[model samples]
Target: MNKSEILNTIHELLKNIAPEMDPTLLGQEENIREALNIDSYDALQFIVALCEKLKIDIPEQDYGKTATIKSLLTYLEKKII
Candidate 1:
């Protein structure tokens, strides 16, 4: 999938896992956990949800690569195909 499609999917998953997060306040480069006020557990939940929905395997070591929307987009793009 293209980055736009990937991004939209990520947004949808984030909404489900973190309804309290205000997308309006988020920047692509901002740290998702800090910007969304989510803890590590919630962050893990988001990652899990993303994997389930997208059928992508994100290794624990690569979790750090997805700290921001921009980074996550880049990581997913590479992993997806």
Candidate 2:
């Protein structure tokens, strides 16, 4: 999918995982931890959720690339395309 579609998917995924999260902020380029208050377990869950949904494999060492929503979407887009 494209960037916007990837972004929207990220937003939707986050909302599913955290119902109270704000959709607008989820789309920001800033750090997702700061933006969403997601801790370590949540981070792992986020990665797993994305991988499961997109049927993509995310290397353990590459977790840093998904630290932010924008970055995660970018990563997913690259993998998908």
Candidate with the greatest TM-score versus the true structure: 1
Candidate 1 C-alpha lDDT tens digits along 1-81 = 788888888888778767876654679799988877788898899989889888988989999998999899889999885
For each candidate, the alpha-carbon lDDT, in order, equals: 0.84, 0.78
Backbone steric clashes in candidate 2, count: 0
| Residue-by-residue lDDT tens digits, candidate 2, 1-81 | 778777777787777767787866654568886677777888788889888877899999999898766677667888998
Q: Distance (Å) between predicted and true CA of 41, model 1?
A: 1.0
Worst 10 residues of 2 by lDDT: 21-30
TM-scores for every candidate against the unseen true structure = 0.90, 0.84
Alpha carbon lDDT at 31, candidate 2 = 85
How does residue 7 of candidate 1 score in lDDT? 87
